[model samples]
Target: MYKAYVFVKRGFVSMLSYRMAFVLTLLGTFVGAAQFYFMAKFLGEGHEFPLLAPYGGNLMGYLIIGTTFMSFVGVSLNSFQGAIRGEQQMGTLEFLLMSDTPLHQILIYSALWNFLYACLSTSVIFLVVVFVLGMDINVNLGAALFILLLSVVCMSGFGLMSAGIIMVTKQGDPITWAFGTLSGLLSGAMFPVELLPPFLRTVAVALPPTHALIALRKTIMVRAGLGEVRSQVLALLALTALTLPIGLVVFRWGFNRARTDGSLAEY
Candidate 1:
């Protein structure tokens, strides 16, 4: 835990060095939300989209949840891989591996700052949607937080798998690219999963982010309790159970292979 804190602190200080970028990112968050807000209102008003029925036909609120959750999902999906790439580019990968820290700890902690930033970004989006856009939000804080944490764990598994691929090949990871692209298109990030065809819907159901977004939207927009989202929660738990171990094993193998090949210092 202390080690994680140190990583988070280091990340925070590093982020502070680029104050303009941080401010621009925050501004961009609002701009993105506003664009979606107007679009949802324009398309949803006086129109019946069965895909949005679960959200009470409030497209803005539905989109707000989707966008916010995807922000975190984006971080969890890319942070570890990006961290590994950054370390390699900076010539620190070998030194970190040579240290006394367990490789898994290093891998996980390295992305802690990204996750923290993601949480902040998600919060900002939610605030903008609720306050700036005057969207009504019913937040079940406890359940929403639980779903968020589970989603992070589930997505981190994918991130670690991607990181493993990076460790070995050093670049051009089709897995990460495909997963990010498909997840964004199919995970109900900016829209509902039901809008997809049956086959694609099935694929979306298998992705942890789909279930996580559904549960999160329910908890936030509908003020649902944990019991109400039990199925989504269970699905996410099952995904985490299956993927986390596999990701760890793959990452360890890749790391060891890179070390053995003396390519850890190579970008």
Candidate 2:
């Protein structure tokens, strides 16, 4: 935990050095939120979407929840791989690996800042949507938070798998790309998954993000309790169980292979 704190502090200091970039990022987030707010309004045409009935039939509320959750998904999908890639590019990965710290701990600590930043950005977006844009959303805060945590854990498993591939190949991570693309299209990030065809709907159901979004929308927009979102919660838990161990095994194997090949320092 102390080690993680040090890493987080280092990351925060580094980010603070780039004040302009930080400001620009915040500005970009606001713009993105505003664009989505208007788009949802236009799409809804002052009428509720039948597909969004579970989320209180409010288009803005539905999109806001989706957008906020998807931001976390993006962070969890890229954090580990981005950390590894950054270290390798900076010629620091080998030095870090030589330390007494476990490789997994190092990876997790490195990505901790990105996860924290993503959460902060999500909160900022949510506030802007609700206060500035006047989007009406009823939230069960505790349940929403729990669902978001589960979603992050599940997505981080896939991120670890991508990091494993990066360790070996050094680039060209098809897993991260494919998963990100598919999740955006099928995970109800922008629209309801119920609108998809039957086969695509089945595929959507199998993905963790789909269930996460469902649970989030229910809990946040519809003010549902944990018990009301029991199915989605169980689905996310099952995905976490299925993916996390496999991700760890694959990452360990890739790390060993990279070390054996003396390629950890290679770009």
Best by TM-score: 2
- Name model 1 segments beyond 4 Å from true: none
Q: Write the per-residue lDDT of candidate 2 for residues 49-134, one digit (tens) a residue.
A: 78888888888877777777777888887888888888999999888888999888898788778889988998899898888889
| Backbone clashes counted, model 2 | 0
Q: RMSD, model 1, all Cα superposed? A: 1.5
Give the clash count for each candidate. Answer: 0, 0
- Tell me model 1's lDDT, rounded to 2 decimals: 0.84
Model 1 earns a TM-score of: 0.95
Which number leads on lDDT?
2
Candidate 1 lDDT, 187-261, residue by residue in tens = 998888877999999999889889998888888878889999999999999999998998888888888889899
